[model samples]
Target: MTSIVGYARVSTRDQNPAAQEAELRAAGAHRVFIDHGESSRVVDRPQWLACMDYLRGGDTLVIRGLDRIAGSEVMAIEIVAELGRRGIDLRSLTEPAFDTTTPMGRALFSINAVSAQLRVDTIRETTRRGLDYARSQGRIGGRPTVMTPDRVEAAERMRAENHSYAHIARVLGVGASSVRRALGAASSR
Candidate 1:
């Protein structure tokens, strides 16, 4: 038999999920799984995993809101698509258009998924452009290298003296890999 299963998540232990659980129950959910102190971004949330395991084909997964299930539009689309693939339906107590049991709802979901994908693509493109601009400005991102020019010079002298990279790194208080890379870069120059 098909069942209506609900999942709810709260980011902090101080937050209560009773209100969401109550709403899911009112919406005909036979069982509600709640994850306290779990962020919606975490797909491995204990209660959410349990809920997914408990659900069967033809089961309807209900949520008070999409935010209870996903942290981003991409995540929401992925979860909805997975449900569709598993022959499970999704319903949002607050978002009526998200009910996948109806043709209109399914159409709306597809539109929303497309919009979400566009937003993700736009963000990715914008970030790439920003990084390219930064590169043009000679500004590098990520952690600064610990190997200084002086260290490189010293490492070279040590290497000339037949010292191992590990020994040079120990003297310079840096990783052997960093010492090797600094020497390698200096040699290439």
Candidate 2:
């Protein structure tokens, strides 16, 4: 004897879950859990956690749509796999093809999940390559240096004349550490 459990969610507080609840009830769901003003990106929704706790091994978890459970394609894949591991089947009221009980539905889901993962990997690789190219072209990122060659020369001369690094920094309007480092590098050379 398997029971049908349902979960519903809305991303914002202003939106209502009435229509989704009605649909879930109409779909023969024995009990429906709901979340308001919650994002699907979060794995620990109060209603979702309650629904999971209420679910048994011989049960089907129903949702109004895939987007209700998954914020992204990667999340959809991970959630479906987790449900399968828990011996809980997933069904979508709006999508007949979203029935995990069928072989065809499982195959379609696998294809979609793999494609989404590939898209993410490709984007990451492209970004890495672009950054590497920029570095090779001498276009470094972040704030530019304030230590000019002239400043280094002046700081070195001041140090040779027994002037303190702090005094040199105050005269040049730069950091004492910068003056010290410049003088140290000149000494090292």
Candidate 3:
């Protein structure tokens, strides 16, 4: 037997899922899952994972809107396709056209998937250009190293004393990678 499973989500803790829950219940959902303070860009959502684990083949997954499942159309289409492959259905209460049970819904999602891929490609290209410009200006990205000059000196002295990289890192309150790099750089000079 197929069961209706509803899900609600809020991007931040300050938002509430009460209204979505009410609507899902009204739509005949027997169980509702919610995720709070979770980003849609992140796939490792706790509540969503739980909802997936509980869902069985032939069950319908319900949501207030498509965006509740995925922020990007590509991801949205992929998720729906995955569900379809599992013999599951997807429905959105707000968008009547968002019903995957209908041919129209399936067509729309296919088009949206292409647009989503384009969007992802555009973002990657723009980011690449921006990074290139930043590099040309001598502005580097990424977090600065934790190893200071004093730490480097200490690391060198410790290495000369035959201390292990892990031991040096523990005494300096840094990582073994940092110790190894510092020692390697000092020796190279």
After superposition on all C-alphas, the RMSD of every candidate to the true structure, in Å, is 3.4, 7.6, 3.8
Higher-scoring candidate on lDDT, 2 or 3: 3
Tens digit of lDDT per residue, candidate 2, span 22-129? 999898898999999999999899998899889887699999999999898888888888888989988998887788878887777778778889998999999999
Model 3 per-residue lDDT tens digits across residues 17-40: 999999998988999999999988
Give one digit per residue, the lDDT tens place, for model 1 in 3-69: 9999988899999889999989998998999999998898899999999889899999999889999
TM-score of 3: 0.72
Q: Kindly indicate the candidate among 1 and 2 with the higher lDDT.
A: 1
Best by TM-score: 1
lDDT scores in order: 0.93, 0.88, 0.89
The true-versus-predicted C-alpha distance at residue 142 of model 2, in Å, is 6.6
Q: Judged by lDDT, which candidate is best? A: 1
What candidate 2 gets wrong by more than 4 Å, as runs, is 139-189
- lDDT, candidate 2, residue 161? 94
lDDT for 164 (candidate 1): 100
Ordered by TM-score, highest first, the candidates read 1, 3, 2
The segments of candidate 3 whose C-alpha lies over 4 angstroms from its true place after superposition are 12-15, 125-154, 162-177, 184-189
